[model samples]
Target chain A: MSLSITVVVVTTSTALHAADKLIASATAAGFDVRVVARTGDDPIADVVKVAIAASSSEYVSIIESDGWLSGEAGAVIGGFLASHPGADIVYTDEGTVGRRGRIDVIAKPIFSPERLRCQFYWGDIVLYRRSLFDEVGGVDASVPGAELYDLALRASIAARSVEHIAKPLFIRSVQSDSGLGGIALESTRRALERHLASTGGGVVRAVGADGVHDTRRLVQGEPLISIVIPSRGIYSEIDGERRCYVVDAARSIMDLSTYQNFEITLVLDSVAESEVISELMAIVGQKLRIVEWTKPFNFSEKINHGVLHSRGEFVLLLNDDVQILEPEWLESLLALAQRPGAGMSGGMLYYKDDTIQHAGHGYYDGDASHIGLDAPRTDPGPLNGYRVEREVSGVTAACAMMPKALFIEVGGLSNLLPGNFNDVDLCMKVTWLGHDIYWTPHAELYHFESKTRDASVHAFEVDVAWGRWGFRMHDPRYWPYPHNRPPA
Target chain B: MTEITPDEQADYERDARQLALVDRIIGLEAQVAHLRSVNTSQALRDQLKEVKSSTTWKVGRLVLAPALALQRLLGRNADKDK
Candidate 1:
């Protein structure tokens, strides 16, 4: 099969050296380049059409003025398209070339159509099948700030197959003064509102000035959420005094939580004193349920048992070591999870001293690495992804919430695999059945992590995980290759 | 999209072949690892069980608690310095 691709450079006016670099890179990759300049009067989509017409290749890729193609990107895209002929649109992982040197190494997941309505996870380095492009009527010229998003949405709807390459195909230079402008936010809200109405019903609202969007799923009355926490009633020293994790976590949920309609189910791996149980009952009254597990410690089994007893519409798998920092945290999580196509929703976990514990789990080097692990709360991780609600391969089950129906559909959690990758396995299983896992920074929590458990993974558990899902880890939907770590 | 000539087409063919070969090699390595894991996993599981059951393990974990605390303290201090 012939691997043919044309490079389209969209620019108002190209920087001389930058253009030279782009031309050099394209030539090196054996791809022909065409420059498409905007006349201020015409839409950007018109400029794109002119560029596409300039070449007769099977695949068309658009490069912005501040972007350059990665080495062998043309060949990579061409090969991918040839092998996967059904794919209408394909995009690759990208990074930014900025004043602080190359940053924002955006390692994107596989095609997430629902997430496209929320945030743009895929950067500008996209390859389009000319047929699909023409079929979708190219990009919507009306949406200047969200032109790619609008085009992507239309293309996604029309596409029989959508693909993502694990490799970084393009590098964008950061614009210092640029942010997701007012026009972009408004357009995004409009697009999302349309998306929600079509996919069910929801309200899309832009929160604050940070380009943060809240896609509030239409509540079918006040749904009951069952918050499950696996507890040992473990004590740890905090702020010069010893405190029980379960007590603190329970206290936070009972006091700090603004969401009223919820139940707390404590799955105990250890026996608690009658006085302790009585004290907890006195605090929470009839809202709490305690289940004893005399068997061996299997995190998955504990959760499964909890879910069996849960009566709520939604189940929140929470760790006893976490404390809710925001009053609206549960509300935020439920809002995102309740959205269409959401398999699971997780919050950004922070350390007691305010460094990040978990933002999202990124697959790297055959294991799950926590994106924004140990970074400061203020740090805007790769492409400011840490600051927004977007789709990820998976989120830690520590604070993940999903509908009870979906949970049962995916078979709760894997029983064979205990500890480490069980949550990841559950996520992969859920995603395999076509669902988007969303991670949001809006729901914040302070995690006293590795406090209750020894945090040890048995070798059998690791092998089982690898045997079952290692083949699919490089699928870009789960784990992308070149496995770049998110910036701190 | 631009038309590729015979010469550029040949280059693309070579690049595609190389990528395909790399992917195959990775797949083969994964297979080998899986086979080895199948042979060794049971013994490793037993070893893990034994270690967890040992008094030495309990003592070691308890001894490491203060070290972890100090390490966290230093880590927070370093972040503050930054």
Candidate 2:
């Protein structure tokens, strides 16, 4: 099938040479190319509007001058469009061309509206259906440096379907400033605020050096959040002092959390000391409920029993070894979980030694592992991955929150694999039911798990997980570029 | 917003320092692990070089040269026939 696509090259006076080369490359690749020269006076959105208006192609792509299309881009895009006729907005993976060669490849995730609101992760080159573009009113000239971001946000909300081409079809110059700062930062903030205002009321706060913003949605009412923590109620020495783990966890929630409309359901083993239970009672007061687990040591069963005893609109599965760092951590997770189509939301967890424990779960090569394990908190990850909220394949149930109704709908956690990969199984069920799981960096917690890592992966659990959800290995949400591909 | 007390501020500062120290230690450990692997690889390369320069290895290669050449010739002929 023949697919006519118009490539609108948005260029500045300084990059006219690059613009010409890009146009030549696009033309060679059998795409209609148009140049929109920006004299640094008129808004870029206005020039792009004119260029798009002059085009008669069914599909239109907007790219910066310093970006070049790959040799197979036209054929790949045409094939994809032919296959997915309902795709309204399409984007591809991109890489940076340095003096040495092509370096720093960015294999972007499938269209994530949450990630887009945090940062402009959908590189410079994006193909939009002309009808969808016109429906979203092209672009907002008032957004200045963030016109494309604003357009993407508007188009994503209005588009019928958004598709991601995994092939790296766009190559950008390394010298181009993709970092958020100055006017781009201000424009991003404005765009995000506008997006929030239109979707739902939320406050945007810029976090991290990479211009990642946190959108705190204003929940309409105070829905009770039930925090389910399964623990042995054992004592651990922290900072040279012996403290009951459950009591410390309870105390941290009571003292540090800003959200008050919540309850704590401690699913403790029956062997737990009475003194520890009394101390937890003292700390949590009337907001705490103890569910004694008489069964074998099964984390899944403990959580399921905890959920059965609790009554709340939302349920948060938290480990007893965790200490809340952020005051509004509960609110942060709830805001994302409360959003439409959001299945589960997890927080950024740090080890006791401060390296990352879990950013999100990434499934690759038939194995599920933490996306950014042991990476320093200062590292924002590729394209500010760790600093922004985005859809993930799964999240560690150590601190995952979801609506109670949705949790029950997915049959809670699987009891077959009671220990390991149970959270992954639960998340897979959630996504299988067509809901997106989100991981947010805004909610910070220190997971003081034992120093000796639980390196045991039972063959039984692996077989069960692999048998049920083997298709997850093909889902590339967090894994980027070369890492996403299976081995030869 | 809840106001943070002086004690909480002190605790945060201490935790921050500890975190920085832990990060540095982890980085150093990674560097050490990388260096150890590089050293091991270099040792293996040197051993291979020594074996390649040995008289026995040279004699073996010289003896196998005719056989290898004949195998390649036969493979090319088979490919052409196919």
Candidate 3:
């Protein structure tokens, strides 16, 4: 028989427009649609639990009143279930219905446990197997806002295969000020805390809120960070004068930085002047160290050597061309790196002209594309999501932070991807190792933008990346919508 | 009116020389900055070699002189219009 599914439509009586549409869609899709209505302080969990108990179907598709499934979703889901009977939870790509009935598609990547811990990239409309749902306790009434997230976590913990439908199967109306309120925020916080506690024994602390929410998992004590810079002492003309990029970057860290528990390591291909070295030492005091790289200009090798020489617990790979914009940038990045599933944390970088350089990166075709590539400083691209702390496929190593142990474990960047793709390769390796890669807008920096490297290496590196980890790059979590720029 | 003594004249000359040396250093530093920007990586060098040998690149190179003149003329005119 066709895989039976009960559409658990949750909603209020006042907003019956959305519920009616969803019911119609479900009915047309040949699913036994069950509408669950709750009003006045009734928790989502209670409603969901009641619905699950009443449903006689094999699977329960959770959909909010405002959320509707695509015409093909029922068939696609049934097909997926028939193919993979073991999968307990299945989610699909979702779209936000905009004004004039335009749908902005949010293309999602396949399952990544690390991505889930950082941000809720997966949509709300998920088909849960009734058997597994019952086994893991259908839902917690206490956790209302993040009940779905909590369930996903529990299901994942139970070692349930959570499959993703690449095609968009759900659509929901985009609402303004629809951000998490007090209760919702609390629920989310509790959900994240429980997830962190269950996965890794650590103290979860909420960092930022409102539009850009951050919950950092602080592990034990204050971990030392080693800021490594690989450079050839290349000089750049800023304003009208010449300054060594490496020296300037070091000076910025020493003068403007607020992160006290960090050391700076300069990995160089050639010996800098004694005066320059002395000046750097004087500026950084005892926090400065220089390591000579005696071979070709291999960024991966330089970083590896720098890590070998570093004494800190975490290694921050930094380019010599970037300058610190925020005093708490390091602190923010460190917090993300200390998260339960995070293997790498990167910062939002701005060009010298104040345009957004790197807000996070999404891989498309064979190359890594920046999120807010050339948008103005405040332009929040499409959905105001560009300026938020979220899990990304990969982040540039221009300001990447990771645990030194994790870096070592992943073999400290690939030598094959010497010049380019090294950062992407490293991030992908971390993801492969069952850890997340995070890109935070909080940790801001001014990247002078590739003053030391050549782009020609990118072509060869792209070949190498395609050869080694090509499939992973396709269909990144950060979907490249046509409207990548901010709405007018 | 100020420098009548030989020692004062010598000091003035010394200061002038120092200033000249500083200027020269600044000039050299600027040149180095320009050179650094123009400097190519090993991969870029390989690409450049391939381009240099290519007939298309060679033909493009031949058209460069006129293109530069035309670009300069257009730029000046556009600036004037602005």
Each candidate's lDDT (Cα)?
Answer: 0.73, 0.79, 0.72
Kindly give the stretch of ten consecutive residues in candidate 2 chain A with the minimal lDDT sum: A479-488
* Tens digit of per-residue lDDT, candidate 2, span B1-82: 1134678647644643443353334334434544554567788899999999999999999999999999999999999999
Number of the top lDDT candidate:
2
Q: Per-model TM-score of chain A alone?
A: 0.79, 0.93, 0.83
lDDT of 3 at A143: 77
Give the deviation of candidate 3 from the true structure as CA RMSD.
Answer: 17.2
Residues A1-488 of candidate 2: C-alpha lDDT, one tens digit per residue: 33588988888877688677688778877888888877654568777888888889998888774778887888888888889999899998887886568456778888887787887777777889999999888978777766788889889999989889988888877776555546666777788888989887788876333556776676658999999999998776777998887787788899999999999988888788878988888899889888777779878768876776678899999999889999999988998898889899999999888888888888876667777777787877777788888888888999999998877666677666678988887887788778988888989999987546674778988776766676455567655522322211
Tell me the lDDT of model 3 at B16.
Answer: 35
Error of 1 at A20 (Å): 6.0
| Candidate 1 per-residue lDDT over residues B1-82, each given as its tens digit | 1234678657644643443353334334545655765657788899999999899999998999999999999999999999
In model 3, state the lDDT of residue A165: 83
Query: lDDT tens string, model 1, A127-148?
Result: 7788888887777777765667
- Fnat of model 3, as a fraction: 0.00
Weakest 10 consecutive residues, lDDT, candidate 2 chain B? B19-28
Off by over 4 Å in 2: A1-3, A178-181, A207-211, A236-241, A478-488, B1-82
Which window of ten consecutive residues has the lowest lDDT sum in model 1 chain A? Answer: A479-488
lDDT of 3 by residue, A211-288 (tens): 334544443567789999888765557669878777878888888877788898887666556666666777778887
| Candidate 1: pairs in clash | A55-B1, A55-B2, A56-B1
